[model samples]
Target chain A: MNKQLVNIKNVTIGYQSKKVLDSVNMQVNKTDFIGVIGPNGGGKTTLIKSILGLIPIWEGSIDVNIRKSKIGYLPQFNPFDKAFPISVEEVILSGLSGKKHLFKRVNKTDKEHTEVLMKQAGIIHLRSKAIGQLSGGQIQRTLLCRALISKPELLILDEPSTFVDSQFEGELFEWLAELNKQIAIIMVSHDIGTISSHVKTIACVNGHLHYHKSNKITAEQLAHYECPIQIITHGEVPHQVLATHKH
Target chain B: MDFFKGIFEYTFINHALIASLFSSVICGILGSYIVSKRMVFISGGITHASFGGIGMAFYLGLPPFVGAAVFAVLSAFGIEWISKKGNVRNDSSIGILWSLGMAIGIIFIYITPGFTPNLMSYLFGSILTVSTGELVFMGILALVIALFFILFYHPILFVSFDENFAKAQKAPVRLINYSLMLLIALGIVINIRVAGIILVMSMLTLPQNTANLFSNNFKQIILYSILISFAGTMAGLAGSFWLGIPSGASIIFTLTLIFFMGKVLKILIERLKRKQKQFLPVK
Candidate 1:
C-alpha cells in the first residue's frame, strides 16, 4: 500500500491579492501525526484550507493519493449556528454526505455506523439532543465523530483543542494518538506544549512552513525557525512571562 | 357551525378556506427553511423587492403577480450572487435591494395613469377575495414545495446547518442553494395574494418560530409549523368574519398570539420538569 497520502508542493495561497502563505511545502504519509503550530493569521489555516480544496492556491500543486471524501475534516468550533435544529445523530450522518448521497435517504447501515462512531466518541447518549444543548467538549466530540464517520484515510482537524476543557483536551489527544495508528493525521493547534507531547512531528507555520523531523522543539529552535509564538509550560508557578523578542 | 355553513353557502368563503390551506402548506414548508437557515432578512428583502415587479406589471397592464415573481426571483439571485462575490457586505446588499425594489414599485405606481390600483389588498392581503386561478397556482406551488422538501431533505438540512462542511462533502451546495432561492421567490409571489405583501412575512415566520419552541428537529418543525399555521389561519379567518376585521391583519395577529402561547407553554413545561427532577431521589 502506498503510504504517502498527500504531497503539497510549493503552494502559495491568499485571499484577494493578499498572500497569506508563500511557497509552503509539506508531505503527509500514512500513520504520520503532524502538529501544526502557528500564530494567528500565519497561514496555518490557509495551508489546510488549500489542502481541503476549500480555497484555491495561487501557485503550486496538492496531489492527494486518496479521494477527496477519504479525507475527513473537523473545522473550528463556534462558527456554526448552535440553535440550528439538527440532532447530534443528524450532524454525524451528514459526514456521509457527498455527490452520491445528495438525493438518497440515509440508510440503516449508515445510521448504525453513526451510532457506533457516537459510541466510540462517548456521545451516543446525546444523539437525540440538539446541537445547542451540548457543552463545548461534547460538541467537539460530536464533530470528531462526524470527521471519523467517513472512515477516512487522512483526518484533518482545525484547532480541535480550542473551546474544549482540559480533561476533554487530554482525552482528545489520547483519541488522536490512537487514531494515528490507522490513518494519517494533520491537526492545527495553538497549544504547542500539549501538542509536542502527542504529535510525532512538528510544523511551525508563519508566512512559510518549517517542518521539524521530531516533536521535541526547543524555544531556541523555534526562534531559529522564526516562529514567534510563545512556548507555554505548566508548573507550580502561577505564570512565567518570557522576555520580549526583538524584531 | 356558521363558518361551516358560510363555507358551503358562499363561493368566496369556500375560496378563502382553500386559499388558507394552500397558504399554510406553502408557508409552513418554506418558513421552516427560512427560520432555520436564518434567511428571514434576505427573504424579507426579496418580499419587498417583488413589489417593484407588481408595480411594473400594473404600469405595463400585465398581471401583478407575474411582475412580483420576476422581481422576487431577480432580487433573490441578486442578493445571493452579490454576497457570494464578497465585494459588498450581505446585509448592506440586502438593504439596497429592499429599498430599491420598494422605491421602484412606488414610482411606477405613482406614474401609472388611470384609476389608482387598490394598494390596501396587495399590502395587507384579501384572502376572502382570492380567485380560482390564484388558488390553482398556489395548489401547484404547495405540491412542488412539498415534493422538493421530501426528495431533498438531507441535502437541504445539511446545507442549511453548515454550508462549508456541506461543500467539503461535495453535496451540490450551489445547485441546492440556487434551487431553494428560486423556490423561495416563487413561494413568496404566489402567497402574496393570500396575506398580501405587508403581512406575508409574518405568515412565513410566526408559525415556524412557534413550532421551533416545541421541537428542535427540522422535520418535526416543518410538520408542526404546517399544523400550527393551518390552525392559526382558520382561527384568524373566523375572527376576521366575526369581528369584521381585515383578513390579513387578523391572520397575522392570530399567528403572533399562537407564538406567544407556545413560548409561555414551553417555559411552563421546563419549570415543571425542573421541579419534578428536584423531587427525584439523590443518587
Candidate 2:
C-alpha cells in the first residue's frame, strides 16, 4: 500500500442509544478503490459517515492523514428545493469553501479552475443554467464537478449512481476509474454486480468491516464473511463464482 | 400630485421612507437564507416569542424593544439548543416556544397596572410613525448584514445548500448556523417596528419569491429582492397613506400582489414561447 489515507480503528456509531455500527476497522491507501457493500440497514452509510467525520464515533477513532478539505465527498441525491435560485457555476464555486479564507471572495483563478473542472465533467454547457432546471444527469455531473473542483486526495461517494441513467452511470464510473489513478476512493452501494467490475477490493459492512482482498467474492466467501447481500450480474456473465449461489 | 407633495413635506414621512428602504434591503439579503434553509416557521416563532419580552417590559415598565431583544435572542438560541440536545424535533421546539412566548406576553400585559398601552401600532405597525433614531438603527443593521454576507458568502452558500458536505470540508457549519439564527432573531425584532409580528414573515419571503421568478443565482436573487421589496414597500406606503389604513398590513398585501403578478407573468411568457416554438418549421 502507498501512503495511508484513512485508518478507522474499532469505531462505533449510533443514533440515540441503539448501536448502528460496532467495532468497525478499515484502512484506505492512497491508490485504493474500495466498494463497500452490505444489506439495507447494514451500517454501510454509517461507516462512510464515520470516515468523513459527519457523525460522532462512540467507541474508537477515525484518523485521517489528509486535511479535511483534502477529502472530497459526493453524497446521495437528496432532493433540493426546486425554487432555490442557484446556478451551476455558483454551486461548483462553493466547493472551494474549505480551501479559501472565511471572508475571501472567489477570484479570477477560482473561476478559471471551476471552468476547467466543468469542461472535464462535461457540464460547461449547463454552467449558467439554473440547477433546478437541469436534468438528472446534468445535476449528477454538476455535483461530481463540485466534489472534484477542490482537487482532493480522497473521494468518498455514497451511492453516486442512484439517480443516474445506465449511459451516464457507465460514464460516471469511468470518470471515477480515471480519478482513482491519483487519489483513493471509498464508494458505498447496495448494487454489487456493477460495482464488482470497477473496484479494486471489496469490504462487506454489516455493523463490522470484513475486508475482501479481491473484487470477486464467491457465495461461500459471502457466507464466510457473514454478508447477507446477494450479487446479481448481467450480460454474458464472464464470472462463474457469481453463478454459484446456493439460494 | 397633491397627495405626494403633502407627504414629502413631513419629516415623519421622510423617516418612514428611509426606514422602509433600509429594512427592505436587510430583509432581502438575509431572507434568502431563511427561504433556502426552509426556516420560515422558525423565524415566525422568534418573531412571536419576542413579544413575550415586549409584555415583560410592559409589566416591568422598561423599554419594550430592549426586553424584546433579550427574549428574542434567548428564544432563538433556546430553539436551537432544545432541538439539538433534547429528544424533540425542531418543529416541536418551535411550536413550544411559539405559544410559550405568546402566553407570557398576554399574562404580563394583563398584570400590568393601568390601561394597556395601545399595542395596535406594535401588532400592526405604523410605518409613518417610525422615528429618526429607529431609522438610523435599521440603517446600521442593514450595513452589518451586507458585510456579513459579502465576507462569508461561500461558506454560507455551501452550508445552507448541503450541510453534510460542508462538514466534510470543515466549513464551521455550527458557527454559521448559530450566527444565522442570531441574525434572524435580531432581524425579526427590528422589523417588528415596520411590519408587525403578524405580517413580518411575508416581508421576509414574498420578495424572495418574486425575485426567484427572474433569476436563478443567489446573489442576483438578493439584488432583485432588494429592488422588488423596496418597490413594494414604497407602493404600500403610498397606498396606506392615500387610503387611510395601517402601513404594516398594506406592505404585506402589496408584496402578495407582486408575488401573484410575477407568477401570472411567468406563466404567460412560457405559454407564448411554447406557441412560438409550435409555429416554427422542423429542422
Q: Residue by residue across B202-231, what tens digits does model 1's lDDT show?
A: 988999999999999999999999999999
Chain A TM-score values, per prediction: 0.90, 0.90
- Tell me the TM-score of each prediction against the true structure: 0.94, 0.94
State the TM-score for model 1. 0.94
After superposing candidate 1, which stretches have Cα over 4 Å from the reference?
A232-247, B281-283
lDDT of 1: 0.89
lDDT of 2 by residue, A101-186 (tens): 47777889889999998887788888889788988778877888888878989998888887778887877888888899999999
Candidate number of the best lDDT: 1
What are the RMSD figures for all models against the true structure?
3.6, 2.9
Candidate DockQ values, in order, are: 0.71, 0.60
